[model samples]
Target: MRTTDFDYFLPEECIAQRPAKPRDSSRLLVFNRDDDHVEHRIFHQLPDYLNANDVLVLNETRVIPARLKAQKIPGGGRAEVLLLHRLGDMTWEVMVGGGGLKPGKKLQIINGPQAQIREDLGGPRRVIVFSEAITPMLDRLGEMPLPPYIHTPLEENSEYQTTFARHPGSAAAPTAGLHFTPNTIAAIEDKGVRIAKITLHVGLDTFVPVREDDPNKHPIHSEWCHVPLDVVQAIKTAKEAGGKVVAAGTTTVRALETAAHTSSHQNIPEFEGPTSLYILPGFDFRVVDAMLTNFHLPRSTLLMMVSAFASKEQILQLYKMATIEGYRFYSFGDAMLIL
Candidate 1:
């Protein structure tokens, strides 16, 4: 399909600059696929729609403080680096924003160690080798890589992270999970809905829009993900009990579907690796029966994914309705539940 088909008009005021005060207080738009009905409610009321037999899968991948300020060693020009993936203890694949960041160029981190460009991976991507392991110093040297649309700075680093975040790797937070707080999760668990955790380290590519005329020609980047045996067992139990598999975000959908995609048998196996599964329209969904996600940008892969889960026309109409209803959009925005 044409990438232009996914494009829509979004007013600048609709973009959320800050998260909801209590996290769970954010608005939620629920769409029932069976009845073609819709309901607008608070995110804290999510448990009302969940059944006791359902399994809610959440992505526990934490967002890293990936953005770093630096200066050229010899010329002293300012630069910025965004860590995308860790290659080793002292090496990372990053996106550099500066001139002359080519191989062999040295840069001094603002308050961290020295780094050298090892290789250029075309465009803004480069392999950087640091003087020492930068992971430990990231807290002091790096800043959260918030989306460019979020003009207001976060009051705290944890503002961008989900309350259940554990394993640190993702460059961006799973916005759908961001709506959950301890109380919200407690209420869901108290309803007897099983909670399962998976991980898919989000990359910046998730926010990148498809530039190609045909979306099929877009190069989707692979993200590291894991679908553990426990999660597989949880899904099996939920399905056997006639329960739905409710994915927290598109990342969770990708991870679970990737596990199913790679399996040779009817059941999904434990998977741990990078997944490049693109959920275009007409894709056969084997795992997820419901989804909770944020309003994505127009022409974005995230939007395309939800379109695949539902239909492009329906999703577009819902988005337009949400806009008219004054629902916030993008990261740190309100959420939508599709079932």
Candidate 2:
């Protein structure tokens, strides 16, 4: 399919700048395939629609304060570095911004640890080695990197992070996970809806647009992910019980789908790897029965994945309706539940 097929018109005003006051207060748009109907509701009402036998899988991969400030050594000039992922101890794959950051350049990353550019990996990315492990100093030296479209600074950096964020790795937040609060989790659990956590360290795969016109020709970057044995068993139990295996976000869906890639023979998939699985329309999904996700950018892989879950035409119509109904869009925006 053409990338344009997934494109839509969205006004700049619709992009949400701030998160909802109470995380769970965001709006929710429910699309039910069974009834071919759409229902608009508040996010807190999420539990009311789910059953005790259902399993809700969430991405617990935490958002790290990855954006770092630095200066070129010898003669100083402003520089910036955004950590993508660690290559190894004291070494990271990062994007050194402000131009002129060439291989062998020494970058004095203030307040954290000293970082030296070792190699230019192209795509404006670099291989940088730090003087020490940077993890300990992230809280002191790093800042939350918001999307470029969101020009306004958030009141609290933690607002961009999910309540269940535990393993710090992602450069960007698994945005759909940002809508859930501790109270929402409690409500879902109170209904006997089983909750499982998987990790998929979100990466630049989110920021890179599918530039190729032919969507099939677009390359998808790999992201680290892990689905535990327990989670796999829970999903099997839900499927056997005729309960839905609901994914909390697209990352969760991707992680589960990666595991389920070879599940035609196995009852469940127990997987851990750097998954580059790209879901497009007509791709058969082995696991994910339902999903709760935020509205995505047009012509993005995200939009394509959702279209694969629902129909491309149906999702496009739903997006048009959402725009007409004045629903917020993108990360820190509202949500959509496909069931």
Candidate 3:
């Protein structure tokens, strides 16, 4: 299908500039295909739709302060770098800004470390090798890398993170996980539902606009993900007990579904690798039974994936209702539970 097939009109005011005061206070829109039901509730009400036999899978990948500023050596020009992925102990694939920053050049972070451009990865990306392990200096030099569309400054660094974020590696947050709170998670567990964790470091490609007319022609970027053997076992146990597997976000769904792509043990595989799985409409969903996701941007790969999970027509209809009801949109926005 065409990329424009997923396009819709989202008002500027619908975009949330900051996170909800209390994370769990965010709104939730529930869509159930079983009875064509659509319900409005608070984010904490996530457990109301699931049963004791269900498993809520979440992405534990934490967002790093990947955005950095550097001074060009000799030239002393200002250069900005947004670290995308780590390649080695002191090397990274990054998006560089500031004109005349060709390969084989050098730059130094003020009161921090220095780096040399190894090669051009094209499209604003460059392979850069640092003089020292910049991890220790991150807290001092790095800022929370908020989305470009969000004009407001984040009052706290922890505001963009999920309560359960454990591993630090992502350029972006697994937004669906953002709405979750410790209390809400406890509520789900109290109801006898199991919670499992997977790691998929979100990439900047998530915010990239789909320029292709044909959705299939768009090349999806490979993001590092790891689904442990225990997660596989948890899903197996849940299914054997007649429970549903509900994913917290699209990233969680991608990690779970990609791991199941080459199953050797009863349709479940223990996966640890980078995945470029572009989930389009008609794609077979083997693992995730339901999903808790945020309202997505128009013509985005995320929108396409959710469209495949729930019917595109139904999603469009519910989205219209959401817009009319003044529901927030995007990363810091409200959520939708598709069951």
| Highest lDDT scorer | 1
**68-177 in candidate 1: lDDT tens per residue?**
99999998999999999999999999999999999999999998999999999999999999999999999998999999899999999999999999999999999899
lDDT string, candidate 2, 67-150, tens digits:
999988867899999999899989999987887898888888986667789998887799999999998899889999888879
Candidate number of the best TM-score: 1
Structural similarity to truth (TM-score) of each candidate: 0.99, 0.98, 0.98
Candidate 1 — which residues are off by over 4 angstroms? Answer: none
lDDT of 2 at 160: 90
lDDT of each: 0.96, 0.91, 0.91
Q: Is candidate 1 or candidate 3 better by TM-score?
A: 1
Clashes of 3: 0
| Residue range with the least summed lDDT across 10 consecutive positions in model 3 | 260-269
lDDT (10s digit) by residue, model 3, range 1-339: 788789999999999999997999999999998888989999998888889998899999999988898999987999998888989889999999898778889998877899999999877999999999877778788877898889999898899999999999999999999988899999999999999999999999999879989989998989999999889988998999999999999999999999988675556889999999889999989999999999999999999999999889988898999999999999999999999
Number of backbone collisions per candidate, in order? 0, 0, 0
* Residue ranges of candidate 2 with Cα displaced over 4 Å: none
Model 2 lDDT vs. the true structure? Answer: 0.91
lDDT at 91, model 2: 94
